[model samples]
Target: MSNDNAAPSSSSAAANGSADSAAPRRNSKRPKYSKFTQQELPACKPILTPGWVISAFLLVSVIFVPIGVASLFASRDVVEVVDRYETACIPAQNRTNKVAYIQSSANKICVRTLTVPKRMKAPIYIYYELDNFYQNHRRYVKSRNDMQLRSNSSQDDTSNCKPEDLINGTAIVPCGLIAWSLFNDTYSFSRGNESLNVNKKDISWKSDRDHKFGDNVFPKNFQSGGLKGGGSLNESKPRAGGSHCVDENCSSTNFQKVVWEDRGGSQQR
Candidate 1:
C-alpha cells in the first residue's frame, strides 16, 4: 500500500510540473506609448475670455494706429507721375484730315498737369511708373545660369538656359533670361518745355557683376557683336518719337511734360 501511494504522489508531482511549464507567465513591466499616440499625451488648452479679447484688440489698435498714420503721411508726401504713352500715341497714318481726327491726334499726347494742392515739405521724392512689361515671365526668368554667375564657369547642366546657354563648348557670359531680353526702353523728361536731365549711370542693380565677361571673353562677344554668325542677340529696338537728353540740368518750372513715346518716361519732383 505504501509503495502504491508513493508512486501516485510522484505521478501527481510530474503532472503539476507539466501544467506549470505549459501555462504562460504574466509580465510585470507596462508597455510604452507609441510615437504616433505620444502627441495625445500632452494636454494644454487655452480659454479666451471677453476681457482678454478686448485687451488684445486694444493693444493691436494702439500699435497699428501710429504705423497707419505714418504710412499715410509718407504716401501723401510722395508724388508719383505715370505716363502711359505706349497706348496713348496714335499713329500719324491713322489720322484723317477731318477736324475730329486732328483733335483726336492732339489728345494722343500724354500730358499730366500737376498742381501741388498743399505745400509739401522740401525734398519731395518723385517716381515714374511703367506697366504692361513682364520681367518675371518663364522664358525671361530662366534664361540665366546661376553656376556661371557664382562659379565663373558654365554649368554642366544647362537645363535652365537650354540651347542658348552653350555654344561651341563655351558658356555665354551673363547667361540668363534677363540678359537675353534686356530692357532697351529709353526715356526723356522735361519740366515746362525745358528738357530735364536723366542720370542713367548706376541705374542698374549692383548685383549684376561686370566680371561676367570672364578672362576668356572679349567685349565684342556681347549683343553688339556677332556670336556664332548670329547678328545680334537682342532684337528689341528702342521705341521712336522720344528725345533722350542725358546728364542735363533743367530750370524749376511746373507744367505738363508730354511723354510721346512708349519708353518709361521721366519724372520731376
Candidate 2:
C-alpha cells in the first residue's frame, strides 16, 4: 500500500513540472499586432514634384518683381546733396604780437561756397547733420526738468537737474541736456544769382499747439539780445547775417535754419 501511494505522488510532481515549461512556450509564441508596433506612429515622406517646385518660384517672382520696379522708380525721383564743411575756418596768425590777441578775427566766422551739380526739384529740404553730437546719451539726455520748463517760479527738482539746476533759489529755465548742448552753427545758401531765404521761426514747432507753456510761466533770467542768454524764438527773424535767438535764454541756442523753395517761384529760404 505504501509503494502504491509513493508512485502516485511522483507521477503528480512530474505532471506539474511539464505544465510550467509549456506555459512559457505558449507566451513566447503569441503573435504581436503590426498596428500597435509600427503603423500607429506618424512619418513624413515629402514628394517634391517639378510642378510644385516651379509654382513656388513663379509665385515669389510675381510678388517681388513689381515691388522692385516701383522702388527703383521712386528712388530715382529723389535728388539729395550733402556738404560737410570740416575745415572751413582758417586760424589767424599771431606770431609777432606778444600779448596774443585772445579773440582772433578768423575764429569768428566761416564761409564756404557750395556749387550744385544739378538744380534740385521744387520744395528742396536742407538739413545739417552733426555726427559727434550725442543727444541720446543718458547723462546728456536726462538733464532737464519738465516742471521747471512749465513753471517760472517752480523750485528745481534736484533729481533731474542735479548740481546746476538750483544755484541760489533761482531756477534754470530750460535746464536739461537739450538746453545745455545747444547748436550754435549757422548756415547760408545762395543758388546761382538768387539768394535763397531761410525762415528760422517756421522750422520750430508752434508753442501754442506743441509746447503749451503757460502764459504766466516765463523763462527766468531770459536773455532777449542776440544769442546772449538763449535767443528769443517767439519773434520771426530773417535768415540773413543777424544772430536770431531761439532759446529763452539765448546763451546756447540751436541755430537751425529751415529753407523752403517753391516751384517756378523765387526761392524762399
In terms of lDDT, the poorest run of 10 residues in model 2 is 257-266
User: Candidate 1 residues 1-269, lDDT tens each?
Assistant: 99999999999999999999999998867658686556766567878999999999999999999999999998987654445544334456654444354334254444544555667565445545546656556775666555554342343435576536655665555444444444333445576889856543323222332332122221112343233221222212211111231222211110111111111233333
Give each model a TM-score: 0.48, 0.55
lDDT, candidate 2, 1-269, per-residue tens: 99999999999999999998788553576568686676776679779899999998999999999999999998887887767764434333543452233223345455677776766787777666666654556765566665554444553544576434543565555454355334445667776778886554434333431343322333443232222322233222221112333444222112231111001111122
Worst 10 residues of 1 by lDDT: 253-262
Q: Give the deviation of candidate 1 from the true structure as CA RMSD.
A: 12.1
Alpha-carbon deviation at 5 in model 1, angstroms: 40
lDDT of 1 at 103: 34
Report how far off residue 7 is in candidate 2 (Å).
33
Candidate 1 is scored at a TM of 0.48
Q: Give the candidate number with the greatest TM-score.
A: 2
Clashing residue pairs in candidate 1, if any? Answer: 143-176, 143-177, 144-175, 144-176, 144-177
Off by over 4 Å in 1: 1-31, 34-37, 40-44, 90-139, 145-177, 210-269
Model 1 clash count equals: 5
Q: Could you list the CA RMSD of all candidates, in the order they appear?
A: 12.1, 12.7
